[model samples]
Target: MATSVNRSCLTYLLHLAQDNLDFRLPEIKALLALRGKSFHPSGDFQEKTPFWCLDGLAEEDVRGVMARSVCAKSAFELWGHGQTHSELRTSLLNYPSENMSPFMHKDSTYRINVYTFNKTLEFPDRIKRIDAMDYLPFEGTVSLKSPQHIFCLLEDYGTDPNDIPEHPNYIYFGRWIADGQRELIRSHSVKNRHFIGNTSMDAGLSFIMANHAKVNENDLVFDPFVGTGSLLVACSHFRAYVCGTDIDYNTIHGRGRSSRKNQKWRGPDENIRANLRQYGTEEMYIDVMISDASKPVWREAPLFDAIITDPPYGIRESTRRTGSHKDVTKHADGIYLESHVPVSQAYHLSDIFTDLLNFSAHHLVVGGRLVYWLPVYRPEYSEETVPLHPCLRILSNCEQTLSSHTSRRLITMEKIRKPEELDGLAQFADGRFSPYQGHNAFREKYFSGLNKRCIKEDNKAVVNGQ
Candidate 1:
């Protein structure tokens, strides 16, 4: 037993939330990268499992990850684990005596918690499970209310809900380290937000986007299509100075219709600034303006540390940009008259992504991140359809299904190089660039799916009448 025990070596176990399964690993990797640590899994590592054992990290590193992770529930310092209860007993008994002695001292007070995944145990059954661990030496006084130390016995019954086994597939014993920032999701929910739009991002996803951007303190984050400033709010929470621009005058100035069911008009203080103030991060609010994304207002050279945004998908809002008629003649000095109103033209989805990538390539500092959403028509979607650029490297692509036939992918990329004059004017013809021209008809595809569904329902109604 002593041969198998090593007091100095330790592993940490992460209990990750089951939802947003695809985003969890990238979020964890990004957070770990913030501390200059790489993820090193112990034994068998499964991405879909709720439980994961991680090696090559200190307790402080685990705490750092928990501080920012919304996808993880809690972390633990692993003592032992095994496939069977008998195997677990052997593993626990072999755990270094020195490592166990410090927490089990007679003067200390501790509690043992029973945590079961995918199954619930009755009171009697839970007590029986706890009582079965009598072989180990725990000299500490049992404290139910306020324990100086907390230990957990976790049982994994596998993921299938309908086919639960009589016993757990695996068992683990560990010391509870820290709980993650899952509460942020509830506290920052869009339903309770001071200001929101019809397509305001959910709180959980907003934070996830910020994480993917690797937002840091004192960083400058920009959102070119900042509708209602949801992304700005998330960046501000991380102590980053947040600013954005929107083509919609109403959205930028917060003068449009209220998104709430009963409210007809927006309140006096219902704006992005008020949102930051609501969360006590108003000091990080840089400012927002009304501008066209195609024509950036920033001066030459890298200006932002990160650019995170969600461009208009034409599903909830119209995609329009400032334009001038070909017949409209310019003045002798090549300027528009003061009385001329800007013409609005349809902003195709293809050009939207092309201009966005070009803007980020030129405006973002090298190594800075660009995180955005790309709408998809499920039947026509493929890896080849995603837009790309020479200077930006794709980091992660995660899909969030909207309906049976429609979905959107969250794309994260990092600016790797500055664009030269020739590269800037390359017209996206390089092998590396896969222009999203095919997606220009996304609006039509989206509505066609809806129309098909409606027709199918109508046919069903007619058949039932017969």
Candidate 2:
């Protein structure tokens, strides 16, 4: 049995509120057990209210899940007395698990997440020397889980200005336990701090990674063409050595969106590199290197234990050109894809598959899985437009069953039974990049498991009470 000391919380980072808490939480408990741990639900929640409470759970039961012996940080003082607050300019975030079974549920678009911290929100504070108890209405459920430098600000009191905390604690929630106001926004409160932007990749896949707190520690994981370094960032946070690469310097992994094609300074030229610094990695610091994955150098036995990547668009289009940052600032949330290059200016989808399969054949180790995407447009458009690679097998289509935007068909492949038979799969190599989805690798981990275990495990399954 995996001892409690060996168990770390599995945090699920995905689109908040898309599925009910019931399906997501219980599955997390099961995933822990899969990692060889004795599991139990300490507490779980939505954006608002207590999903699980320590009051009902015995102290022993609470201790079962809150294994401090294996915690990353010794102690975190969140929700000490009143409300804690913080803000972020990125995609996802993390916090210890909490209880949330109250408040009425809302629509699919209104996403939220709930959390609990170590001995936090346990007892109300009574410090009066700073007139602490009644000062500034400071409180519990503070946003201490944030990776951002500023969280839980203490209101500027003593007019001296310098007397206050650098970014002091602001809001306060007493023993009353008021639910968080921004629960509906799935930033730091629920989603894992993987990618830089919100809702770019599949949230179901992102949720699984963000929610995952621990893994086979020290495992060597790879995310080829890591869009914005989302999968790799989450993997690093989940206790692994991460590697990611891309074709050019205009992506999340690449240099800032704006550089000089004509030697003119445009925007924050150091943004992407600076963003990576915050996560504690430098170029080549990780096991990754920039190169074309189409005809990659494959080792018979890969030094890497796992592989995850979001490849370039078979038809990629974006605004990540040499001077796109200035334009992005003028655009909304840096989302306008105004200028760019064609991913595959040469051929359509068929050539892409042949090359992609050949790349996987040589690079992906035996028993190592390759999870990728296959978009099937609405049923009516039937012209065999999307190319198919013979080696890659269709695994599942959970997204189609749940979402309305576009359904993704999950695909997977292992080494051919006989190595000599690697003839047909072409040598696809698309050089273009887009800022949209790099969920290729992680979604495989999420759905490939479902494809193997439960057939009905998806967003709709939660609503249908599976």
Candidate 3:
């Protein structure tokens, strides 16, 4: 009981990668939620910083989060921290001797690493920092190559590159636990992907999306607008059974023009399943079919464990669906020729989200998440613009900036209840609930900024005569 109490009170330090500043917290929180844990900061917390001190987690809980987190670089069992070396010494001396004795035994071999955020230290300086820790009782032999235990001395120089501090703003020392899955980003990069499209999701962002959805082993995942199946690839990597639908026949069959440079056409072997196979997750691939998002073909039941997708923003890929402005005439027998082709019409961004939310409400299991991107004209964006449904609740809204005037928000929502008869008509009854209809003009606003920039460049060129 005493050992368990000591373990429960232990604080853990997380060294998060500085990139994707907006996504690190949500990703970590979702991963912790998967382990049935809550995020409890030990002190004043700064979300943008590289170091985070957490409480209310066991060593196994930290390892479980590290196993799937891409935002975090490494986790440690915090021993002592302070703003100055003298204070750190006092803190370390005040720490329980029993908690520090196991790893510092004479028979053990260990190594210490010096990590400085937003700064670099010379070899002599790093060695001096290690020497400064001689005040602690460490009887273990130092092993530089391989060791049974690893510890780190982390210093924060602040986030600003313009201002470099002579002394660190904060300092922390801890025993290393485990490293996060950052290597997955490099290994699964779209640049090296077998099959890709014009708008394939980035490898890091793809994994972040999967983490945000809390995808787990054997979970059934679906993507409504699965272009070349980048999101599917991420989900399958997490051991989920993945499938998707797209309206483009060529893309669905991988017979279209190649997305690779200098390659005019895609090879027969290049397809969504082949991409999964390339990563040795072909068993997770269920199927990919040519279908429209506006007209889902799934049965009326909560089937999917999670829905993750990146819908077309009418920029790189035109938002379209199977439909026509003109009326179609049916034969007396109500049949059409097998060779007849259906026409497609513009799928406005507003209606696209409406259909997506409604579909998720009907198809996603209770507590299942729906993660997707929503393009925004930054100047006119507001919380009210986000689409809402009676059965679904919004969880997170993170932004990825594209240009000065344009950006995309990664919106995560969960199904809290089944849809009722009035749920489908709730948006119509309330104007605020349907403000996304104004987003139909997103494409126009997106291009208007570019046109203005071009005109300005032209005026400057005319003023400064060649």
Q: Highest lDDT among the candidates is held by which one?
A: 3
| 1-466: candidate 2 lDDT, tens digit per residue | 3333222232211111223332334323423433455434223433322222222222232332333111111111222222233232111123212321111122111111222221122122312212332322223323335412221212212223345443323232211212211221243222343224321354344324333322234766666556555555545544566676554545543344333344333244333334345556534236445444443555654455445554543333321212222323344564556463424222223333445555555554554445444544333222233333343333222233333323454344444332345344232332221111232232344345446455545656887987
Residue 320 CA displacement from its true place in model 2, Å: 14
Q: Per-residue lDDT of 1-466 in model 1, one digit per residue for the tens? A: 4533443257999999999998999899989988889989999999999999998887889999999999999999899899999999999998877878888989999998999999999989889988998887989899999999999999999999999999899999999999999999999999889989998889999999999999999999999999999999999999999999998888887887899998999988889999999999999998999899888678889999999999998989988999855666667998887665577899989889999999999999999999999999998899888888888999999999988999999999999999887776565557547576868888998999999999999999999994
> Which scores higher on TM-score, 2 or 3?
3
Better of 1 and 2 by TM-score: 1
Prediction-by-prediction clash tally: 0, 42, 0
Q: What's model 3's overall lDDT?
A: 0.93
lDDT of each: 0.90, 0.36, 0.93
Query: Any runs in candidate 3 off by more than 4 Å, and if so which?
Result: 330-339, 461-466
TM-score of each: 0.95, 0.41, 0.97
User: Residue 365, candidate 1: how far off, in angstroms?
Assistant: 1.6
Instruction: Give, for candidate 3, the lowest lDDT window spanning 10 residues.
Output: 430-439
